[model samples]
Target chain A: QKEVEQDPGPLSVPEGAIVSLNCTYSNSAFQYFMWYRQYSRKGPELLMYTYSSGNKEDGRFTAQVDKSSKYISLFIRDSQPSDSATYLCAMTQRRAGTASKLTFGTGTRLQVTL
Target chain B: NAGVTQTPKFRVLKTGQSMTLLCAQDMNHEYMYWYRQDPGMGLRLIHYSVGEGTTAKGEVPDGYNVSRLKKQNFLLGLESAAPSQTSVYFCASSYLAGGPFGRGTGELFFGEGSRLTVL
Candidate 1:
């Protein structure tokens, strides 16, 4: 089984709608979850990050992690056309001195239309 | 700062040809990584460096090799390319600050990808 799985959604929604993106993982050791946004021809930028199981909010974006369920989510409120991008979910386990390695999901493409 | 920058934004390589992709970061970060994004496969790690003069294999490292001779640069080399190696390659860097609680080691700053087509 793939370590991390996410729906490759070309999910389209109207402007002002709420958008939710999610991912599930098989590794319970993963302690950090992150969301990255990538626009066409651009690199993936860090959107939101969370440690362990909890929720972190940043403006219109919210990231939630449930370690028990091995699930994580990113919620976007009042979506706009500018919000159209591929959202990638990534997870990492905390290790000593060495930096953690990341495992990424098949990005979900989101389109917020006018 | 340019953050992380990748060279040769696009390239076409004939099968068995060798090429090197360069990634330079001005952030002085200790950790650098190379990942390839394929259609439906997401971004899979090719190789990574924890510090200068150090390299480690990642999930997909078979057709690729990497080197980190400088703290600010990491290079991924394709020794004899294959059609299966065609993908968008990205390089990222992150710093270790205040242990692991403040932010992830993978709080990556990415570069504009290098798209390689191995024909």
Candidate 2:
């Protein structure tokens, strides 16, 4: 099984709708969770990041992590056409004296239409 | 600053032909990584360097080699290109891990990307 699993969704929604993207993982050691946005022909950029099992809010986006269930989610409120892109979930374990390496999910493609 | 820059934005390679993809970072980060993105495969790490002169293999490292002789540059080499190797390559960099809480989250800054097609 892959370390991280996410629904490869080409999910389309109307503008101003609420969007939720999620991912599940088997590695309990993962402590740092992150969300990344990738547009067509572009590299993925860090969107939101959370440590351990908790929720972090930034602007219109909220990231939630449940360590017990090994599940994480990203919620977008009042979505816009400019927000259309692929969302990927990545996680890594924190190790002292070593650089953390992230393991990413397959990513969910989201499109917001007017 | 140009956080990370990849050379040869696009390239076409014949089977068995060899080429090197260059990645330069102006952030002076200690950790550098190379990843390939393909349909349904998100991003798979090819190789990474924790520091200059040190390289380690990631999930997908076969048919590819890497060198990090300098602190600011990381190079990915395909000794014998294959059709299966065609994909968009990305380079990323980050500061050292494990600082104060939420201080160093290992948030990576990525380059635009290098699209390679193997014929």
Candidate 3:
């Protein structure tokens, strides 16, 4: 099985709706969780980040990590057309004085319509 | 400054052909990475460089090679391109201020991806 699993969602939602994207991983060693948004023809952009389990809020985006279940989520409030993009979930372990490489999930495509 | 830049934004190759993709970073970061995004397969690490003159194979390093001769540059090479190698390639760099920050730690500062198609 893949270490990380996310639904390849082409989820369509009306503008202003709340959107939730999630991923599940089998590796318990993953301590750093992240969410990225990728527009067409561009590289993925970081949206949210969290360490260990719990919730983090930034603007309209919230990231939640549940280490016990190996699950993580990104919540988008008041979604807009600008929020339409491919959402990717990533995880990695902490490495001192070096860059912690990331493992990403198959992105979920989101489309917010007015 | 351009955070990260990749050359030849797009390319198409026939099977058995060879090519190299170049990635340059201006963030003065100590780490650089190459990842391939495939449909439903997600992003798989092909190779990475911790610092100049150091290279490491990642999860999917087969059929690919890499070099990090300069602090700001990393190159990924395909000795013989195959249909399976067709994908969007991305290069990323992370600042050293944080403890080994990955893409999640902050904006990874990715270059516009290189789209490759091998027939």
Candidate 4:
């Protein structure tokens, strides 16, 4: 099984709707959780980052991590049409001072319509 | 300054052809990585560098080689490309500062990505 699993969603929602995206991981050693937003034909950009567990709020996005459950989530409040994009969840375990290898989910594609 | 820049935004090559994708970062980051994104497969790491003159293989390093002779530059070379190697390639850098240096403590600045197709 893949280390990380996310719903490959083409979930369509109206503007101003609340959108919740989630991913479940199997690796207990994965301590860093991240959410990335990728636009069409563009590189994935970091949207939210959480180390270990707990919730972090930034603007309209909220990222939550549960180490015990090996689950992570990104919540978008008052979603807009411009928010349409693919959201990816990534996890990693550190390796000294080097960059840890990141394991990513297939990504969840969301479409917010006006 | 451009956070991260990748050369040859797009390219096409026949099977068995060779090419090198260049990545340059101006952020003075110590960590750099190369990844390829394919449909449903997500992003797979090709190689990574922690500092100048140091490199390590990643999840998908076979059929590929990398060089980090310069701190600001990381190159991914395909000795002989195959149909399976066609994908969008991205280079990313991270600045790890403060904190306890946890598992995921830094933000990765990524390039625009290079799309290559093996015909």
The native-contact fractions of the candidates, in order shown, are: 0.66, 0.77, 0.72, 0.55
User: Regarding DockQ, does 2 or 4 come out ahead?
Assistant: 2
Residues B3-118, candidate 4, lDDT per residue (tens digit)? 89999999999999999999999988888999999989999998998889999999999999999999999999999999999999999988654424543466677899999999
| Candidate 4 segments whose C-alpha is farther than 4 A from its true place | B97-104
What are the per-residue Cα lDDT tens digits for candidate 2 across B38-96? 88887899999999999999989999999999999999999999999999999998888
- Which candidate number has the best lDDT? 2
Please tell me which model should have the higher lDDT, number 1 or number 3: 1
Ordered list by lDDT, greatest first: 2, 1, 4, 3
TM-score of chain B of each: 0.94, 0.96, 0.91, 0.93
Residue A2's lDDT within candidate 3 is: 94
Whose DockQ is greatest here?
2
DockQ for all models: 0.69, 0.76, 0.70, 0.64
Cα lDDT tens digits for candidate 3, A2-112? 999999989999999999999999999888898989999999888888889999999999999999989999999999999999999999876656565888999999999
Minimum summed lDDT over a 10-residue window in model 4 chain A is located at: A93-102
The CA-based lDDT of model 3 is what? 0.89
- What tens-digit string does per-residue lDDT give for candidate 2 at A19-54? 999999999999899999999878899999998999
Model 4 earns a TM-score of: 0.95
Flag regions of model 3 displaced more than 4 Å.
B97-107
B1-119, model 3: which lDDT tens digit per residue? 88899998999999999999999998788889999998989988889888999999898999999999999999999999999998999999776536454433534678899999999
Kindly provide the TM-score obtained by chain B of candidate 4 when compared with the true chain B.
0.93
Stretches > 4 Å off in candidate 2:
B98-102
TM-score of chain A of each: 0.97, 0.97, 0.97, 0.97
Question: How many Å off is the CA of B89 in candidate 3?
Answer: 0.8
